[model samples]
Target: MKNLKKKLGLALAVTLSTVTFATAYSTTAEPTTAATSENVNENTIRNDEPTSDRINQFKDIAMYYYWHGGDIQQAEKDIFKGITLKGKYDVVENAFKEATLLDPYDLDLKLSLASTQIIQKKTPEALQTYKQILNLDPNHFNANLLYGVYSKVNGDNSSYKSSISNLKQIDAKKTNEYLQKLETTETILDENLNTSAPADLPQKDHAIVILGYALAEDGSMREPLIERLKAGLAIAKQYPNSKIIVTGGVPKQGITEADAMSNWLISQGIEKDRIILENKSTDTVENGLFSTAILDKEGIKDVTLVTSASHMRRALTVFKEASDFYNKMNGNNIDRNFTNVVYLDYPSLEEAHKVSKDEILVIYRDLIRTSGIWQYPGLQR
Candidate 1:
């Protein structure tokens, strides 16, 4: 009877050991589902059931959110998180590769990978990635755009020229599409410009007007600039406005356009109270954004955003996008809100010399404006 009890006890020990081992193995080596296509049924994605499908759903959600809100960094982070949370790097890499394979026609993924490689300073890899994109799509607009940007960043002027050349080769209809976008932008701007703000247009009590970018140190006002500023100041002067934020930092550290403009405007005998000097914004976007902040803090809301007539569309867009005018009025609960704005233009005489190249410039300018996050947000027009 004692021997029988000893054998039973040994069998219990064996059973417990097997159970523990199984538990440990199950915990450590969990079956990981890859965030890949074949492993995930596309239909299951909408239901969010399978692990891979859930990951895909997360990716789609993140992408949609980012696209609408203009939040790319967040999108990238979310995508990386969704893939990596599966606890597999190879799986993530394979997913990215599978994405490229599945949509062999799409260069965005390839371009994204190339941009990542460029950021990591992996030039050879970036080059290979771009080459692969070019192999798949010889005339991909984004590929050319990024190639030009990378070339310019790396001082590869030869490559830049090649990329620019390739961009020029886009068919007329596609080029027209870009132009139509600009035309639509201009239509909105013109509609806004030609109309008077509501009877309760916010009055700028002590606002500043910053004369943005223009040719440096040119003594005389260019015709376009003159016409634009004249129209702008005429409308603004009707509002009993107190100050002008004349701002422009030197693109090159010589006599800045802002100083020249201030001197010229003051020479016209505009009161010193009317001009608040801000001779320190190098680019148009900075001129608008930084000036908006400064003026907003000073309790000024009505602004005449003076720039070339040609630049009014972009300037207005930037102000709309970046300025605190909207938030400040709503935050302070100030019923007497003022977001009044105007545009000016001053195309240089030197433009006459380049009249022959206007067609080319028009195309190249639009391409450059649309291809990247330019220094000025709305200046594409």
Candidate 2:
């Protein structure tokens, strides 16, 4: 009876241990199995779901971070991280592509995507995207303008003419003016194609116009502004007789770009009377428009325009176009020639292999504005 009792107790102990071990095993295994199953389900859904649905989902997430989150900087960072940081162009392209799928009516997104495609050298894709934009808004200013410029650059003269015609319907006065300038440009291009002329340096006695950049938040000159100023100063020193015009506005609280430029030039020993302050213009288009008015008042016909290299092409084009319009409006068309403006490129701190698509798009926009297709917002006369 003693031996039977011992054996029965041992068996009970064994049974309890097995049960405990099984319980512990299940506790660990069940959660892991559940987690794996969840992951698999997600993968399956991603694979099986329609692309449009997935695109909408991604766009919804992007919109949440872009607007509802109230953190635009963070949103831009997240959206552009793949491209800006990792140089993963495909990732950003895909994101924009997906986002556009859900919001086909968003003109801005389409423009952005098309610009990115151009930057990537995907010309065919960009053309298709531009076509899509036109389908949505046939007379979209930016779309037609950019498409025209792109077509012109790619040597598609037929498309270029078509785009110009479209623009004419949108703004006839501006289109006529731009068409004249376009013909002039083509003539110059033809001349250049036949014979390369020696590069002519800027004349020292020409009026010097220093284009303004944004000032630092503390009212100090930002590096870009300082660089522009430095270039202006050098030119001013070289051309003591030339009148200097500094163009910019008080975009921040403390001071205007013109003010900073004027102060810097004064400190460098330029006379106050020689410097003209144009502090009301906010953007490049306004810079050209306002500065041209000043030039008209001063009876100045020639100018040496100074700005960053990355911005040089647009700046030169707008200033020339603005001056032409001003001349025509004021009936000062004795020669019908645009202003004799020369460009001086101040290299930007950022290095790029080629001009970016964004820059090109901005050039087109400014060109359209200069053509008088659209007036500056809140502009008086």
Candidate 3:
């Protein structure tokens, strides 16, 4: 019986060691068929879901793309498509809410969602989102910067001050830099708002700047382009000695708007030497930034900014802001003015009515850009 007991104990020990070895092998091995089958089942469910379910699935897909796959642009497009298809602010809010749950630490996701909320006029929701971001990461640079701008636009002076204070504490260099530009913008905006009309043209020695519009597909001068060039020519004729600055860069066919404008102006008997073509700018902000650099280099401080009446507000604001930034950076006190705007009439009243929202948003966006946030690449102009 003692021998039998010893044999049984030996058998139990061998069985236990084998079981342990098998468990270790299972744990260290590559994923098993069960895991693969589970993934397949998930894919099957996703494929079989209804259209709404498929659409809602984008939240998870976007998160995966952003975090796991490291494809930010694709993730952004996926989220954007979800919002676009829904066409409702609440739906967008919900999509962001679900995404945030998946990646609670994602600052970019929070900022994008907040921006969307602001665009949708969901101020309270946006404010909450901003608060959440600040709470998560108190020193988040973009969050603080954009929150300040948005607060100012929303007329929440208290929140704006708080955000600015927080910015100063977290990043004093950026705060001071942005403050200077913000002050310049505020001064210009106040002056602009108080004045009803464009300033009268300076009598002498001031440059004439014609903001270019779109050229035809074949690089031909179109109506508005022709109108703007004509208006600039009239101003040039008035101040024959003053240089003409033609600003635009978007190309058609093979020629830029500035090139088209220059050709048209030369064709209409304007001297080529008197025309300064700024063919590097792509948008109004670039137009202002690039044109001002040339103006400063040429010692042209006073300018008669000419564009369509609908565009005058934004164009003038951007020009003034750019000029202010240029002057501040160069330590030169130049008196930049947009006193004279030769209005190129819009095609019709309907087109004119399409101006206000776009104009205001551009002005606000450029002001933020001028404040040293979201700066484009290049010479920091």
Q: Which candidate number maximizes lDDT?
A: 3
Candidate 2 C-alpha lDDT tens digits along 315-351: 7678877888887799886232222222223232234
Better of 1 and 3 by TM-score: 3
Local accuracy by lDDT, each model = 0.46, 0.60, 0.62
Q: How well is each residue in 1-381 modelled by candidate 1, as lDDT tens digits?
A: 222212111222222333332222111112223333445432222232344433333323322222222223322332333433322222223334544654556565565445435433555666677778777787877666556645554557788777767767965555544445444444434434332223443454645354555653344445554544454455445655556667776633356666666666666666656766677675555666667666666776555555554554455545543343435444754332233344422244233123222222233333343334341122211
Number of the candidate with higher TM-score, 2 or 3? 3
TM-score attained by model 3: 0.62
The candidate that achieves the highest TM-score relative to the unseen native structure: 3
Per-residue alpha-carbon lDDT of model 3 for 77-193, expressed as tens digits? 433434333334444455556556656776666765675576566667777887898998989876787777777776788988999999999989978977876676555443322
Clashing pairs in 3: 199-339
Deviation from native of the Cα of residue 106 in model 1, angstroms: 20
Could you give the C-alpha RMSD of every candidate to the true structure, in order shown? 20.0, 18.4, 16.9
